[model samples]
Target: MLESVLLAGGGSAGHVNPLLAVADELRRRRPDVRVVVLGTAAGLEAELVPAHGYRLVTVPRVPLPRRPTLDWFRLPGRLRAAVRVAGQAIDRSGAQVVVGFGGYVATPAYLAARRRGIPVVIHEQNARPGLANRLGARWARAVAVTFPGTPLPGAQVTGLPLRPQVAELVAARHRDAGRARTEAAALLGLDPTLPTVLVTGGSLGALSLNTAVAGVAADLLAAGAQILHLTGAGKADAVRAAVAAVTRDARPGVALRYQVREYLAEMHQALAVADLVLARSGAGIVSELAALGLPAVYVPLPIGNGEQRLNAGPVVQAGGGVLVADADLTPQWLRSHVIPLLADPDRLAAMGAAARTVGVTDGAARVADLVEGLA
Candidate 1:
């Protein structure tokens, strides 16, 4: 009976991914239901939403003016126009429910849905709810949150939704880790025999992460663990140079098979092959690692409202991952802790199991249920 629904959000993977997951879930539940996405041309959604075969209705980006400038004075008019555009899109799509995942477009979508007397389902993905969701939640007919402690009105804890490929890897991760690891290693051209540590700073790369992990590539390789480091596109050169330096001063016969890459199209494979991961504690990264039951060292970005740290807290408490301050992720600490941890297969397996216990792979289904209720 659900005729149509609009999923609103985008900008980053954190928002867009969940929106797409909900979209996928809705269609899976009822293939006849029409699902549409509302996002700005600037955000990641412009490319991803279209690529995913969803109908994307583009809206002009009207960022909430923060500075005391001319843009601040023009906020009212811009917001009004965006809301009008959203309302028009809603009418055109005949969307019965507007599900919001929080971004620039979310505000207008929330307003438009609220004005049209349509049910609004809000999904807040971060422990620290973003501004758009903070305001939208007040009017949301139903509210879902990825983290339990997220300070939002009437929020039900629905964990971050895993992508389809991630779900497949999670299944493989449970069915046969050894087989998965071998296949993944082969897919990525990595050494299946070696204990592997996957390092990623994110799409743009983290300067702190690249520098610290690159400095310790030799130490890790020497400890019998190879590094599959995704150094972001721009940071790859620096990482390559660092690896070369380590190779030059290497001990007698230590052949460091450290792989440095700009990016990996198949991240699921990376997750499958890795014994450990060192990365930023973004919602998507943390959730994927948890779902796959991969142990990790989460270095929360030392910026924003400390949300990244909060995001990694639950994982750390479950013994699935370790959390370290950005300033504390030195080569010495990595050698002292990571090397010892890598050597202990029992501890690593225990951590991975604990991570699986805390992770919720069926988050998209849960969120879909909430949206369906609104419909």
Candidate 2:
């Protein structure tokens, strides 16, 4: 087993969530190993890394320049400085091995570990490789990926690392779905018997999803399916306005069926009770939906090399979800496709049953095992 290790990844929940999942697994399996996180003070890791009981070492944030400019000219010096800082952190922690999840922190950590001749492992959470992990894969001792056809050299498909709470909920959902859903409903203050549809577009919310789904709020609620719409922070006003407009001059109690939340900290409960999800197809969210057996309507973000669409492909192909284009998401689409799907209990259940086939719950442990061996 590794005596001491350095974990490098961060900037967003996509990177840090998996890093923390693997960290939790390692500590659970072997309590003696010392773990340290390398990240930036501004990244999400600033709070999560220490909260998880690991020493955190921070460095300056250096994003790889995409366009040629003065910033591009200064890239080499900035990266060299970051690598030096990362090397110091590695030495100070006495880390026997370094594990990097794809993020700004990854490249520097990988280069520093290589300099010290330390074992380095890379984890890619998406089907399409990010620049950091794509480069790191070449020299990594081992590479783990969450999806197949990731195009990483020597890649092992280990699936996304579900957080412990999420993993347990997923396991419970698989074992006793009825009870799990009931408990989750109670936790989220939802009607245990009501079929609920969950809508979320990540932390900041997706305007397209929020607008389209809210446009059909009255229709969905009238169909006897309660809607739990998490309209990420700062965007709740827009969703509420949309729903209000839709429900204007409508029958009494029409709005009662729709619940709009700005953000949900207890997402596990939301996952537990959801019969379907209407959201973005980010790799992490897709993995969660698949692991929890929640059917989804995936709207790929209209940016970034069409990666989100690719992330949802396998699950959609497996009949676990539906993939809709960003612009095509509208009131008509929701009424035509979403309403009927919710109304069909047989189809919903069938999709839910198939979800587990597209995702795995053992990713944290699997990645831990891979990194442990390297250590």
Candidate 3:
């Protein structure tokens, strides 16, 4: 009997995407329930939330200061201000429950919701739970985690919620794999019959991924494989030049098969046509690939808290995907490993099937069910 819910998360797509997915599922299940989003004006949610047709209420960005600095000294007043606005938003929306997805806005939203005696549910997107979610989990009505071993008390493994497009792709692929591939290939100007490899380093591009994959583009092309390389932002020119340098002496029409784009608005089409994926193993992409039953070579980013590597560990162990270190993904590595995998259709299909076993496509529905029970 939930009349309204406030979904809180922002700063990155990893947070906003899942929040939106759960919001969509909640709306679909209970059309009359009011859905409102709480985010910072500076985060990606500012643009994406409104575009998704949700009512977005914003608060001032209040990043937690890790060390003693000006920000740390000012944190108290800033947090208080943010919490005040969050409470105002909760009151205005008449939110019966607050759903937090772990970002700067989450801390304040959690505080506000708890102070108002409203229930809160949390969804932690990463294997390593963030500070916001760590705090929220202390008294959340229910906790949902994308990765199995995420250290949250009383957390249920619900997997990452897939975007509508990705969920639709999963359903379509399930209905008819070959027809789905053909239709997606036509949309992306790819040949459905040819083995296709998708290489991406996220929206801003990964230097290690782009350089290593581009260096080996000719090897992949020579193996009768087509590439849909989404070079992030301005990295395409450099990748195109590297591919040209490597394949200059190759036979004609081989270069045509190497399509390098800066970005793709419809990512599901790219996912639909890919037989294998070579990319960074972010939580979102790892969950998406698993849900779609796509085999992948996950090159974990070398930076951060090493969560990317941890994120890919379970799927790799399950024989669904291969985890490669960022520094280890060289041209020589591609020649030794990736090229042969691309040539083996049986192995690719087997790996795809294995990935499907670890994936959960109904994560949004699961989270919605949790919300409904608590609300």
Candidate 4:
């Protein structure tokens, strides 16, 4: 049996979902192929990979802090542990090819594959390469990217691989517009007459996005707009509390409404119903928004290493959304940009059309073709 190994660990949905998309494609193309994902015991992969009916081999968790401190000393031990775990996992799986999807887990997985004389491929999901992928690039036999202009050498720009639900939404575009709208609204429990805006900052949530949404909750309610907010697990309670407080003060008969959750199980429903979105510019989120033809206001995370800012550029240039600096994401700016669009149906529709133009729904198939060619 042909086997493949995937490296994905220690991150939110941004990291896990792309790996799942590619894995789904791989299974669709080759039913008998056995796929093993190398992940940490603590990450989303532990649950997500197994839930998708694939085996997940646990590797050591070696997370690097965004800022350097005394913890830097732990790096050597962690690296050693990761290398050992990765080597064992690859050997046991008898992997013909190992693909690193960019994370600490990937670093060791790629190294173990190299030492075993197995071919290695790296997939980068950002416009700017991450630290792990940057190092893995040197030994990678093939490199795939989600955006143009990434600095990695010999990389092929394959766009972002979207989940199957998203692909179905794109394919269903030919149906009657009103029917699509009704279906989406019914699925999301939204009032068909009012406009809807989706607010999400990756799967883990962003404080900046949550804060801005809280401050503007009243205004959105007053304008007859509803919200579907996904607050990361860490900040869900705080965001829900703030929204409840705002909703309590809202005037009677105003259609200001919200459905707040820590993580959304029905992202397809939310995306389909949304007329506008406020989110971070993570490559995966950007790709999804574009594919769904949803207009957005993107706030790039201030932490530079995540490379979120670079991910927002294409949609901003395409007039599909506005890119806001994290520090500058105040309630006033959000109100100015979002309220006007919600009030103007024509402009909102235009932005949605522009967003659809930038989407590459065939990204997974393209990347799968490349992988097949390599074999």
Which candidate number would show the highest lDDT if scored against the true structure? 3
The 0-to-1 C-alpha lDDT of every candidate, in the order given, reads 0.89, 0.89, 0.93, 0.80
Candidate 2, residue 111: the lDDT equals 92
**Judged by TM-score, which candidate is best?**
3
Could you tell me the C-alpha RMSD of candidate 4 in Å?
Answer: 2.7
- C-alpha lDDT (0 to 100) for residue 74 of candidate 2: 85
Across residues 1-375, which tens digit of lDDT does each residue of candidate 1 receive? 688999999888889988888888888989889989999888999999989889999888778754588888888898999999899999999999999999899999999999999999998888999889999999898999887789998999889887888988888867998899999898888889988999999888898988888888787877888888898877899989988888887765454478889998888899889999999999898888888888999999998888999998898999999999999999888888899999999999999988878788989999999888877
Residues 232-282 of candidate 2: C-alpha lDDT, one tens digit per residue: 989998788877887788788767668899999888888888899999998
> Model 4, 1-375: lDDT tens per residue?
345655554455667887888888988989877788888777788899999998988877776665798768998888888888888888887778787788768888877888988777788988998888888899888889988889998998888889888877776654555566678888767776778888998667898889888888888887889888888878888777877787775666443367777887777777777889889888988998887778889888887675888897877789888888988999998788788888999999898888877877877777766666655
Candidate 3 wrongly placed segments (more than 4 Å): none
Collision pairs in model 1 = none
TM-score for predicted model 2 compared with the true structure: 0.97
> Which 10-residue window in model 4 sums to the lowest lDDT?
1-10
Better of 1 and 3 by lDDT: 3
Q: Which stretches of candidate 1 lie over 4 Å from their true place?
A: 66-69, 249-256
Q: Kindly provide the TM-score of model 4 when superposed on the true structure, using C-alpha atoms.
A: 0.89
Q: Please report, as a residue range, the 10-residue window in candidate 1 with the lowest summed lDDT.
A: 248-257
Question: Which portions of model 4 miss their true places by more than 4 Å?
Answer: 1-10, 64-77, 174-177, 234-256
Evaluated against the true structure, the overall lDDT of model 4 is 0.80
